[model samples]
Target: MNLIETTYQLNQKAKHIAKVVSVDNATMTNIQLRAGEDIVEHSSKNDAFIIVRKGKIRFIVEGEPVVVTPENMLHMIPLEKHDLHAIEDTDLILIQIKP
Candidate 1:
């Protein structure tokens, strides 16, 4: 079994922050955002899974707004337009898999 720690310090001075945590069979990324910061609408070529690790985030998927908390997650299908807004200081993991 592989164990990893996802703890990270938020860069309050930056509008957005992201880093690759691990990658092999798939790509895993750690993304952090301060309240009011957001990722602009975009689409991925691959499917993706997002897990809220610290706070809350609002995901606008295909023109629908969905609020996700630490206890919940969001999945994005390939080519789906989506955007993310930090409702509070938030940390999340994004796993992407090529189809």
Candidate 2:
């Protein structure tokens, strides 16, 4: 199992991201964001699983905004347009699978 500790201190800037675990050419990334941090509306070429590790995240799917908090997750179908926003200090893990 890939074990990781959520070290808040290690998460700085957050503009980039902190690598957590990846295998077999797969990519796993964890991002810590302060309140108000958000990604612009965009589409994904690969399917993505967005998990809320801490705090809450506000996401828009099909033009409707949905709030996902700790223990909550959402799946983005490939090439789906969406918007993601961090309502509060949030930590999110994004798992990407290459097709």
Candidate 3:
């Protein structure tokens, strides 16, 4: 059996990004951001599923605003443009599936 630790420290006034898993078809990344942090507009080449584990984030996807929280997730198709703004100290798991 294999196990991976994905815990991250919260409340820090900094942005932390780490790749926790990588395989033939997919990858998982952990992103932790302090309140007021923002990820500038960008696009992904692969399909993406973002799981919000803690706090909240405001996502601008294709110019549309979407509020994501631990209550729900966000998904984007390949080449979709998006940006993220941390509404509070946030932690998220980003999964990308390659074609």
- The local distance difference test score of each candidate is 0.83, 0.79, 0.93
Q: Rank the candidates by TM-score, best first.
A: 3, 1, 2
**Clashing residue pairs, backbone N/CA/C < 3 A, model 1:** none
Report the lDDT tens digits of candidate 2 across residue range 1-99. 656765674255655467778777557888777778888899878888888878888989779888988767888888889887878888788888878
Candidate 2's C-alpha lDDT? 0.79
Deviation in Å, model 3, residue 91 alpha carbon: 0.4
Answer with 1 or 3, whichever has the higher lDDT.
Answer: 3
The CA lDDT at 44 in model 1 is 91
TM-score of each: 0.85, 0.80, 0.94
lDDT of 3 by residue, 1-99 (tens): 569887776644488999999999999999999989999999989999999999999999999999999999999999889999999999999999999
Q: Name the best candidate (by TM-score).
A: 3
lDDT, candidate 2, residue 21? 80
* Model 3's TM-score against the true structure: 0.94
